[model samples]
Target chain A: MTSRLTVVYGVRASASEIKARAQAIAVEQSVEMPLSAIHDGSILSDIVGQVRAIDDRGNGAFDVTIDLAAATIGSDAGQLINMLFGNTSLHDDVVLSSAILPSEMLSAFGGPSHGLSGLRERVGAKGRAMTCSALKPQGLGAEDLGKLAFELTMGGLDFIKDDHGLADQSYSPFVDRVRVCAAAVRKASERTGHPTRYAPSLSGSYTDMERQLGLAREEGLDVALIAPMLAGPSNFSALRRNHPDFAFLAHPTMTGARVSPVLFAQLFRLFGADASIFPNYGGRFGYSLLTCKAIAAGLLGSFGGLAASVPAPAGGMSLDRTPELLDCYGEDVMLLIGGGLLSAPRERLAAEAGRFVRAVADHCYPRLSTP
Target chain B: MTSRLTVVYGVRASASEIKARAQAIAVEQSVEMPLSAIHDGSILSDIVGQVRAIDDRGNGAFDVTIDLAAATIGSDAGQLINMLFGNTSLHDDVVLSSAILPSEMLSAFGGPSHGLSGLRERVGAKGRAMTCSALKPQGLGAEDLGKLAFELTMGGLDFIKDDHGLADQSYSPFVDRVRVCAAAVRKASERTGHPTRYAPSLSGSYTDMERQLGLAREEGLDVALIAPMLAGPSNFSALRRNHPDFAFLAHPTMTGARVSPVLFAQLFRLFGADASIFPNYGGRFGYSLLTCKAIAAGLLGSFGGLAASVPAPAGGMSLDRTPELLDCYGEDVMLLIGGGLLSAPRERLAAEAGRFVRAVADHCYPRLSTP
Candidate 1:
């Protein structure tokens, strides 16, 4: 009656060798001893991960599926992650292409509180994809960054977040920056009567984090940004569990190197990110279009009956690429453009944002009038 | 007066092309825009990262140092990490070799609270190098694990942590395991008059984590294990900050791919681990000897005036390699033996632990009596 996790391992060995390796994995990943060492009455007998099926995927590469006992990982994200690929990550041949955790285990780590639809509802946008951008070049004082946020939000972007680089540095201390930027976004909403969600980067000590989160709430900010890779998945999950009102936008920064894009996106959604941000393909990052599509699919599709999270495609996005991106990801995606907007002349910044919004509008609502 | 980060990037282009790529990195990782677009009063004008030096290392590799305004990252570890190699990590050719954060920034992250001397004092050993082992083979009931802990402690190991596989599974829940393991170590210490610290894996909800730490303390445990890659560096740092008494042992899991062994070890130490644990070369994992040596050096070396953290190398460690492990790591090492000890016949388990401990002691205190 135990639930299992099916993991597809890319192993390099002969058919016979694969069997040996699978047997080794069964021990290595769990008991770390031969079957004889495990006692008769030990619970280890029941909970040991088993290599169920091995399918060859050409040239010494076999898609080894290991069924790990759900009880082994239990409810801990950290332990589950360790079981998934901790020791195996160091091995070159064992690439973890996919992992399907049992529902009982997945539910323990609560998924997004406010998912794609909830986020779209918060943005109050209809018939068009959401546009997200960053206020960047981190050395700015809180006042200056706040001003930029005001301009961008007023210019028609649905979501305005701090750049992944924005942290609690002296130039813009987190408390000060979040306070000012939150205020600025509110002011923009007041003027344009169009609310734009501000997601400040979450970083610093737990006490400091609590204060920052509280401050964002006090300032009426709806969304918060956290680079889950840097902060850890558990921390993010804890935040999502505690704060039901704030939508989380998970940033993929300083972490794309280790995690496969699709897996990262899937975990991001599973860990309660309303918007899972990633470096889009055909952009500055070398992610393939297929990987981006896969990531998008993972975020939007249902797994473990969790709510669908938004797929935020970022990095080198320009107004010109909006239609192609729309064609690629369809309607339920967030187009995050940073450098491209900063490339515009300051006098034309608002106009540039407006153009990007119009560009998205045209693609999504082709027959309808631009609103 | 701004501090800079020195990064060596592995490029796939000519010398001039490397220079250009370095230039691109400066803007891409910081402003994410061309300098021409930045205006007089913009933050990009003042705080944009500068490519200070680019040394051609031949073979399309170059050591490029980018002098970024310290204010760009601020003091948050998450932000500093993001700024250091976030966007660049997505680049296939870009490999980060070393990073020197400003002293102010480094101190803010807070390196190991309980370092080499502190750990040595905690285990009640003045001169001899410490011994550490694991209580693993995950399926064991709390009773067996507790008994095993008692034997290993009596056999003369300083530290005993859980196998990365050991989690809050149904067979052995975390709370129950910690209680049994802690009591066993305490009983062993009572008889042997030697302290053997038990560090259960910290890998669940913050509440569950808090309870585990509390229970460990309640039962007189001194050390706790955390895999920072899975739990997040910030969580580990916060734990170190909050619990000054407990020694933190970091497990390198699910993270070796993104970070170089040396840099990863350095960062682990920087984030407040009393000991940095990683897979050694010639073990089950594929880390090279040179890389393992570098990791050991990183843990032991003085960086930002932080105390030295012990280098605990494990994964397929055995009694035979103890002398070589000691030779490679010198005295400031914790050789983690897992299955090696587990494979020993039930009657000879304690004796096997004693031999391994003697091997380490022989290298460190060659002439000293077995006191």
Candidate 2:
């Protein structure tokens, strides 16, 4: 039977010692190993298996994988995998790496409730590149931010997301912000005969989260951005089950502390995010280039059962870096440039973003493909 | 005028560089300072003045404090404190020390609805020390664990708690386990008249948490144990509002990740915990004796017209160490002995627990000044 894998990185200890610690954590968090299992030197024989790997940098980092018992991890295997990482964090220097769990792998979301083709179809972009930007820096009044968002949509950006920091602050209350931004986007779309979608940040208590979702629906907003850790685990499952019509764009905030370099993609995809936005390789955060590529690959990789999620490489994304990111992450991607687009003059932002997106598409898919 | 204090530890860097980084995090997480604040050097000046003290522990550990702007924190000051620590964590070796925000502390949960004297009155332990122990080592079945709890209660322990690891699992399903244990504790209490109360672990989804609380109430359980972080921020407040009659005992499970030598007592005390349980000094957890003492002092310290909370010291506690812990924490504390009690023979566990409790009482109120 194929089992879920968990890769942990830690200081270089004796192989036996590392194995013992790993087994202890697995038993402590999942199934407890009996005395006989230990005596037989198969303490984790039923629940997990051992793998060999080491960190070359030598800053006390080693990589080891454990095979998860199907019983230990129930139907919600994604959450089980996350719990493995979370529980192991009780120890020192154990960062989560990659995970291979059972789930649908083709559709954009776990099973792409809407894949790239579907999303592009909805946006009326068959084979062309799409430019996205964020309504940023937070603390701005709803009216001010909404106006900026309208200008950007009119200017030609395909997507406009509220900055990850823009939660339910009073300065820009979620309801008012979503209403204003949605109206602006719609107005721009009507004026330009071009469509633009808005994804507002959803980070609040369960009740407040519901209010935000309801407000987005009322205002006819295209997508709702969410950060699971910030919102809480049940919120996502509840939103998916109850509010099936609401499109979700998941942001990585307060989440990196758990998954780190390894199991991020699998967890995010399984969490049921349509498009998972993560910090890029050369960004303000800590994810490495190889790890970033792995995230994209894992998201697009073959999953026997799990749904696929679109990898949105964000953070410190600039026009100059578009080609590099696109080359690394294939055509099935979303280039989220937030602050960089905002800093430029309003007139230049849309054209600059559009040019960068075209360049990325051309470079990644040399032959003339779709839009 | 009391400012929030945050302690950050980092490798030796110029004061200017550290100042810049600290200021940046403050602005990023908190209220954004105006250019005037940055230009007049008021932002940096404020940080400098707010820093009550700085202690550099040569071995890459440093403690520094900052007076936070109240406006930056918003209505939820505790969240602001968490944000302060969360932001600083991106930088290496930075630990949050103590946070002393504006007084309005207990206004949140109205302090401990029932404190030491109240509990004593309710349990009718006017002259005796309260005995307590946790059901532990995890791995055991629910029925078996319930049987042990019965023995401990019959042995005259005042309180029985589930080990922090005891969550909703298949082996010991939460509701069934709670029903059996609560019933057992009741039977034991009836036979002994010691009024042993059971507090089961309440850590999970919001809906499930409500179900757990409801089950506890239906089963005639006295208190509900919670780990706030694992549950979420709004959990305590919601619990208090929904089940005003129930007593909430917050546990420290996913919290050590935040407060190990970083933030100090002031912040945790006011953040909605009526009886905050932390790892004792010289325990397996590595917190210093001084830090433990500080936690106690902070919890019991008066905060802005709010009543004090009982500090419960736990983890790696033993019967032998009871006298020392009692002497250090005094009578107002709740002594939590877990594995030590579990390891003892069933026949002697209660008396051993009672002996430890009596010793604490003898150390604290010796004779009650019968004049």
Candidate 3:
């Protein structure tokens, strides 16, 4: 029985006291702890394991590892993790900094089945940081955006996607926008002999979302751009599990709930985001550099037996920041440059994006060829 | 366009500074206010009207409001409100305490379409305080829970529901469980001529959820219990819209993300919960009495402009505290008592619940009934 071990560390509380409390909690909720001398024959024993760990931050949060002997988590591993967080929520001073779960739980629900490696394989980007662009300034028509996509792929971006706000609005209906943009990207890819994947934004009423997915499929779009917060986290996992072949590029609309300095990074990865885009440290939206670094570590670092994920930092980024970002993020990162590139001249769009990608590649892996 | 006004109250910041920031956001994102005089316009203005009220909360949080004119909230009122909330979210420190909107949004979302009046009319308990009981001791079999439900309904609980944790575990497959329980309650109702309604827990995977609801409908259950956090907030609205005939009872499972003293209550109502169940003050959970009062007040109290909703206080509630709870939360409240009742003897279960309800009813509205 592979279990979740959450190591808690704090002060004003002894390990013995914490252990007693943990055992009590286990008995009160899950299986009873047999090791406790205080254990009575009255309650059912449900606890399978527990242990304490050191916290470098010296924060009041206790790091406790909980062992599950059975398949307590059904299909939705994310929800199960949420329940765990909820259970310990009665205490305020106690912070849940991290959670470790087995890969089986993720595999049980088909979590990130294609991850970064598989996605890169499909996109045919074997090495080097991939350049991605977003078609934005929402008020534009589908044809106008499609023309921009043509130039962007022609310029050098390996991937292009719709901005998170690009819902099925009158400015650009989802199906029409998807058809035009995907075709343009495909034409550019064919001419250049490089696969430039197009991911269209997906957000709407239930029927509308289903229609958007269907239309994307019909148009042969490579990835479906979805904001997990807008479409619901479970919705992303649900869609991904259902359409295993379609690459899920999750956006971050209305994602304020998950960005607290303490819990943001780990929770996002736990919810099964293959690639999560957060407003960078120095970016306009205000996530601290420390927070960004933690998010990167949480996603790419080995923990809970889950596979690594891509941490995409966007929002108010520019070409000059490419080296700095790549230097910080390393090779596994996805450099998403949106409005900054789009605001430039049409011809400069692709060239600037290509330049930015080349700079990142040169900075991260200097041995790799620029072409 | 009855636009949304988001009031963010925090430490005193310059009004011009705040307004400038708001205007910058409006232009950069939505309506496009020029950088020089960006403070003049707001996101709401694009839709309708704008009013920025900034107040210092002594704490670091600032209180600001953006009032939208009626034109902004056109035919798609529900979406209009969502857009309002979404737009303001792009900024920070805007702890949304209230949302002011016209009746059209309520109608569009079919809010408590059948509110307290309609609910009372259906249950045939118009005047007296309603009685409800949750069948629990989570690990029990379906037949055992159904038998308990039968006893409760027969012994005179107005409503019988499954404890929120009673989802589709192998011990109690939802379809078979709902069928047996609904039948048991129906038999009890037939015998006693008491119109006791049953609402079973229905939090499952997307497909399982749809199937569970279909089964609940087939089994003639009056209401379906849904934990918005465990499921999704949109799921509640979508379910209500899809199953117009059925009533939804929303629970606060794994909903701690929004339970901050500032935002929890009002947002729950806006997220479309007819009866929003939260942890009561002085329970095993740790919400302050003031916070609980605020939640209740926010639910029933008139805000900038929002509909009244039922504040359901559950989670580790005991009968001894019923009188105190009733005193704190006046009438028009649903007091959900779970584990305490489950601990009672089978014979005493219904009578104990009825006694508890009678005590609350008597304490709150003495003229109505007494045990």
Candidate 4:
């Protein structure tokens, strides 16, 4: 029997038309043609997707579960996504909600080489949630961005990442930016006695990213921020495999509207993201509190003996809400406040950063409370 | 002065909130921080996204145009997408409608190494719409698929492509499938006295794809199919740059719901798709006739001295509708009939495919049609 993985999709259709829709999705996602056209008995029995279950959610929505052959994927990450949601994504009425991967598929993916615990060890955070910020407002020169990185490091933040916008632009070439920021973080760490990590955003082709990674490694940087959606899931997987020592923070860019956030977090972690960053509830974006909790749970939940990934909630997050965010997310999280910390006066930026770090540290978790 | 590109987004908001929402999108996409925090003179003057126009489309909908600095893109296809819709994609209320790319930005991308004319020359097709079909129902072995390819070639189709689902699966590995299919097409072409290009689907990491291309070249196959969205835009661009002799058929998978299909066609062509395949109107997907026309126009229209890409309309297309489709798309298109021919009995499959070819060949395009 072929190894199978289960995938669930939230489909919008009337009750009467749901069975055909679910079956159509199963065929559309797998054989992609009439089942009678398939001549091979093994192919018919094993390869064609089987609709496992369909539960109506009312208001023109239903949850559909499908079982697909693992042989069709063959340890290829890109093909896995292609099999999971490639052609089906074309149907506007369907949303890929979740999946239950077989053990072999999970083993093939090899989630998080350096996950939450590894990240904590790198930053030396014992029992408190991590504090993080971003270097933003694109077109800044390397020296200027380095100065900002220095202040954030001085304020004892665990991670200072490059804004996803920062790439190999002429104004602040990737090499120059990494060199200066690495040195600045190292210099500040020597004084503050905190091992704050600086994660530069990666861009360009897979080869370009490899070259960038070489430069980052030369600068003694281990953590790197990458948008898996922008880089392609296969490239991200390849990078992770090639650089086992490097911890990755997956940026939720170009992906938010494509798939469910919970599924994305799970996939990112499985693809080797030590931390997955996303827009928090009541932020600039539209993810609700319930969705945020699910994303966090998906990342931190147990799955196929893989390490847990740190969920970094961000996007227009403020220092004032740090306690509430921590209370909701618990301790295995990274509170990323970007514009909120940057909004402080230039002279008082480090103080504001310190306050963010302190806010997370001072927050007490409510006993037996569900986020 | 910084070179700028204009990106238009369709926003879902009230008339009263359109201005603020548009401005917020500008700031969020460019800086990802509050404008007050950016004190750099050049950054404020040049790097910040400027709202150029906003037109109300009624019923809480508006078209908003924002000009972003071209320098931020930095000659990187992935970063170009990141700058265009990365963070904004997180906002459910927004949809990327189109972009007016700067010439330099256009030059950097360098659309389609071997576009429509080049592809037409390869198959010796002239003065008529090209005929194409996909080898589908993915679980067949290499030899079985090869036999199908031979039959399709015997039918005198212009192009035969691998189904997007036919990846490097264990059931039919890419190398074996490509080798067999290539040989089969060659054999059938010798007998039929017509050139039928075989386009194997490309998948896996960049390095893996490069190796696959090498294998394809060895088998004397000049055309290959790829999903730019699945491969990552930068990797696709790099592949085009690295292999100037090859023709690419861009598959619209994992991309349909994210951006406007018209914009997707333009972007795919810009990233080097000789033929951009999309769901035709009245097909399995939900694209309307107007949207399909716009997609075709975007692919065929003059843009920055780039070669025109053939818009291949596919998905649940049939032989009977060939004349109607020909009238809708004209001679500058590739009419793809997949399952329509495959549904025929094994004995009549070639005859059905021949009928499909004849349908396109016999149909006369309407005079001065818009599509």
Cα RMSD, each candidate: 3.6, 5.2, 5.5, 2.1
Q: Which stretches of candidate 4 lie over 4 Å from their true place?
A: A368-371, B368-371
Tell me the tens digit of each residue's lDDT in model 4 across B1-371. 98998999999998888999999999987887999988888898899999999998989989999999998887898898898999898777898999999997787789999789999999888888999988977899999889889899899999999999998988799999999999999999999888999999999889889999999999999999999888989999999999998999999888847588899899999999999999999988889999999999999999899999999999988888988888888999999888888888777877887888888788877786677
lDDT of 3 by residue, A1-371 (tens): 23443433232246456665555444333321123322223223333334444433334345444443233344553345434444444344343444455566545544455567766776666666667888865556699889889988886676788876566655577778999998998888888787888988776444456677888888887577766544545666677666766776665554443234234344445555666666687876667888788877776777555656667787778778888887777777788888667767776776776776578657745345678
Q: A1-371 in candidate 2: lDDT tens per residue?
A: 53444445443456546666555555544433223323222324444344444444444445665555433434332235334553454344555555555343222223335545555655676555456778865456688778778877876666788876666655677778888989988998788776788989876455666778888888886577876555555445456545767667776554535345335555656656767777788875566888788878766676655556677888767778877666677577888887666666656655665565566556745455778
Q: Model 1: runs farther than 4 Å from truth?
A: A11-26, A33-36, A40-45, A59-61, A364-371, B12-17, B40-46, B53-62, B205-207, B364-371
Candidate 1 docking class: medium
The full ranking of all candidates by TM-score, starting with the best, is 4, 1, 2, 3
- The residue-by-residue lDDT of candidate 3 on B141-242, one tens digit each, is 689879888888776666777876566656667877898999999998899887888988776544556778889888887587776545555555677667
Rank all candidate structures by their DockQ, best first, as comma-separated numbers. 4, 1, 3, 2
For model 1, residues A96-141, the per-residue Cα lDDT tens digits are: 7788877876687768898888988998877678998888766767
Better of 2 and 4 by DockQ: 4
lDDT of 4 by residue, A272-345 (tens): 89999988999988899999999999999888888999999998888999879888998999999999999887
How high is the DockQ of candidate 3?
Answer: 0.26
TM-score of each model, in listed order? 0.93, 0.83, 0.82, 0.97
Candidate 3 C-alpha error for residue A15, in Å: 11
